[model samples]
Target: MRAEEQVEAVVVDDIAERLRDGSREALEEAYARWASLVHTLAVRSLGNHHDAEDVTQQVFVSAWNSRHTLRPDKGTVPGWLVGITRHKVADVHAKRARLARDAQAVAENTLPDESAPPPDDLLATRLVLHDELERLGEPRGTIVRMAFLEDRTHDEIAERLAMPLGTVKSHVRRGLLHLRTRLEEVDRDPS
Candidate 1:
């Protein structure tokens, strides 16, 4: 294996040994060393720092809670931690996406009328959409809003954002792909 993988293997071995020996300090150290890495991976995949941190904490807490079932010979502890982090990240992403879709549906059903104030549900959905857009970050969120939310053409978004047409198109495509993946995740969940 590569040097980094070798180091990871060593760390996993040490952590497994500590757990087997019932050393609390070693378990804490293992969590400390891997938490940042796990969080970073989660944030990259989920596009939300809060969700990433949650997944990271869940991974470590579960590892500790299930320590009795761990078998080092089957796999490295770090590998197992990564697997848990991935599942937890997916779960959180699915939940957030479902909330977003539900909010969107409620928003669509309660349009504002000139004679009356906007419905509370519509206002809530707008807030959730705004928060989700902000969480998406950068040109991707802006591009998605302009192209999809605002009904602007890709060329229009390019002109508005002061970017090349191809760049705007790329951002729209990527943003849509990400959104689709999140939606599919929500659909797949039994909960």
Candidate 2:
């Protein structure tokens, strides 16, 4: 190998060794080197910055907590971190799916028996739309839910959420537009 490349490899190996030996400075160095890689992978997998950031933090914390299990003989530190990131991403997916299912169950139970239930396709569509709404995250998600689902006035949502009227309106408008695009995609794919 080239001398420069060999030097880089040795440096990395030294950092990994220090990290596995329970050195906090090594952990910080590792984060500085690889946090962006982890964060980017998370953003690509999760499709949102908030969850991406959460997953990034979880990955480092997990790596530090489980450092004793890290075996350089098995793989490099980056490879180990990638494996942890994949697991964390899967966890987020499972959590999102579970939340969607719980929301669906609540909606189903609240229906009056005397009323004719919606068709299966309609119910499925509602579930997908609801899931997208949740993916919006934060003030946008809550604002859209309050404004559209609950049929609350903009002023009322503003008062209740303690957000400015303009901000509430903006969120609702943008959130609806995003949902509309998602609905269009669903219509095209129907999967």
Candidate 3:
């Protein structure tokens, strides 16, 4: 290796060691050295500047959070950051795909008519609500789905799920409340 390369490697190793030992400045140094590389990778993969920026931030935060998992003997700091960037990019892609799927689902669920189409905001709102409902999970998601989406009565859901009518009612009530809270949060999130 060239003399300058050797010196740079020594400096990089020092920073990685300090980072693994919990030095915040070392983390900053690492970010300064590689943030652009990370951001470029994200932009190349995601094709959106805002998503790229978000992914870059996510990668650094994840790297700091997972610093102890870094093994300098196994790889350079840039290599580790690249790995994290790949994962973050993949996460953004997966999230996009999931949203697309949710949108398609909403479209499919809507009444089909040549005369009228659902408004964009209505579709977006349904997508958000569907996502929130998924986050609810388990018996609550099932109960709410039956009660609202499938247009089944509480007694019918209780009989179908083999749960007490009161329990079914409770799940639907709480699930709807949680969905409402999540909707409000989405309304407030700006991004």
Candidate 4:
């Protein structure tokens, strides 16, 4: 192998060891090296940057928390991380699929109670909007929840999340647009 490959092997070995021991520093190093790959994988699979970012964080946290499960004798750290990433991406996609299914049911106006009570149109609309907001995921989902569900102002959300005002606003705006598109679809086909 080349000298660079040797160096990388040594580094991966070190990370593997640190990870096994639950060292926080090694977690940071691992994130620095592999977060981009994880994030990109999530984004490509899920097509949502917010969801991708959440998945990347989830991958690292779950890996580090369960680092004891990783065995160097079995595989390289990068390969292990890739496996974790795949599972996390799948989880995010699964959640989205569930949300889509729920939203579709709401859109179709199906209910178990035919005479118990009338379908709450506003509640159904909220459910659809909330479903899309969750698809935004993580900070965006939390941000939208605070702003709408909690009646928080944009500045308040930024302050609470320690995010810039512009970023909070952007998330809210984009999230609203996503919800709008979903609502329009439902509006066009309310069965």
Tens digit of per-residue lDDT, candidate 2, span 64-94: 9999988877788888999999999998887
Clashing pairs in 2: none
Clashing pairs in 3: none
Give the root-mean-square deviation of each candidate in angstroms. Answer: 16.0, 10.7, 11.1, 9.6
Worst 10 residues of 3 by lDDT: 105-114
Question: Cα deviation in Å at residue 127, candidate 1?
Answer: 13
List TM-scores for all candidates, in order: 0.52, 0.60, 0.62, 0.59
Candidate 3: regions farther than 4 A off? 114-191
Q: Tell me the TM-score of model 3.
A: 0.62
Candidate 2 has a TM-score of 0.60
Where is model 2 poorest over a 10-residue stretch in terms of lDDT?
105-114
- The list of candidate 2 runs beyond 4 A from truth reads 112-191
Predicted candidate 1 versus true structure: per-residue lDDT over 9-70, tens digit per residue: 88778889888677898788878777887888899998888778778888888878878767
Cα deviation of 159, candidate 1, in Å: 46
